[model samples]
Target: MIGSGIGAPEKYRKVVVEKLGYVTGLQLSLRENLFDAAQNFDDLAKVSSELRLLASCLIKFAKDLRLLSSGPEAGFPYRE
Candidate 1:
């Protein structure tokens, strides 16, 4: 059986005292992809837009909170 994956050895070379005990492994390369099928990006675009909106809202809320609790004589000062 042949195996292939991320960790699987793709290509290499080694030597041993042949004609005693040996086995051979070979791999063939075929590059004949004239055109890869088109992939839709609409879903990705929508998710990116959603993330941008959420990030923008969170950033604005954080800025507002910082402004509210900033200077001692400004928005709201913490008494200690």
Candidate 2:
């Protein structure tokens, strides 16, 4: 999406990829411990909530970039 959306430079894109990797790791850990709390579910739920909060920001960023790449025409993908 980065390549087809904003044409982010390779170096900057690499940084985004690295950060996404961290997000993946956190997601996996939360999944593994999702039910470990059983009753309270405090820690796992907090981590999940925080991840989702961060995801909202990323979602907005992606949407804005998509709109920018699309300009006034939303009929087709930018790269095509």
Candidate 3:
């Protein structure tokens, strides 16, 4: 039983390493998306539409945060 348990840590380490690789890939993809959004605004109408969509997303996120932090100890406590 002790010998069998010896491989558990190795297996867990392998899984963690694999997950870190996946997270790194996702981070790179997000960075690429940000770069594209920042640099590729050629059309004025498209830029206006994208800006409106971004504003709406930000507004919704703010509303969600407000709703979550309604009570004193309900959600995340942010300090300014």
Highest-scoring model, TM-score: 1
User: Which of the predicted structures, 1 or 3, would earn the higher lDDT when compared with the native?
Assistant: 3
Residue by residue across 1-80, what tens digits does model 3's lDDT show? 11223345656645654776797774321222434456665555788999999999999999999887777677666577
TM-score of 1: 0.42
Question: How does each model score on TM-score?
Answer: 0.42, 0.40, 0.38
| CA lDDT of every candidate | 0.51, 0.59, 0.61
Q: Model 1, 1-80: lDDT tens per residue?
A: 11223343333211221322244444423222212212344645899999999999999999999887787777667588
Worst 10-residue lDDT window, candidate 3? 26-35
| Error of model 3, residue 15, in angstroms | 57
User: Which candidate, 1 or 2, has the higher lDDT?
Assistant: 2
Number of the candidate with higher TM-score, 2 or 3: 2
Q: Kindly report which residue stretches of model 1 are placed more than 4 angstroms away from their true locations once superposed.
A: 1-37, 73-80
The local lDDT score (0 to 100) that residue 9 gets in candidate 1 is: 37
**Winner by lDDT:** 3
User: Residue 67 deviation, candidate 2, in Å?
Assistant: 1.0
Clashes of 1: 0
Q: Write the per-residue lDDT of candidate 2 for residues 1-80, one digit (tens) a residue.
A: 21142355656655665777797774321122223434465766899999999999999998888777774467345574
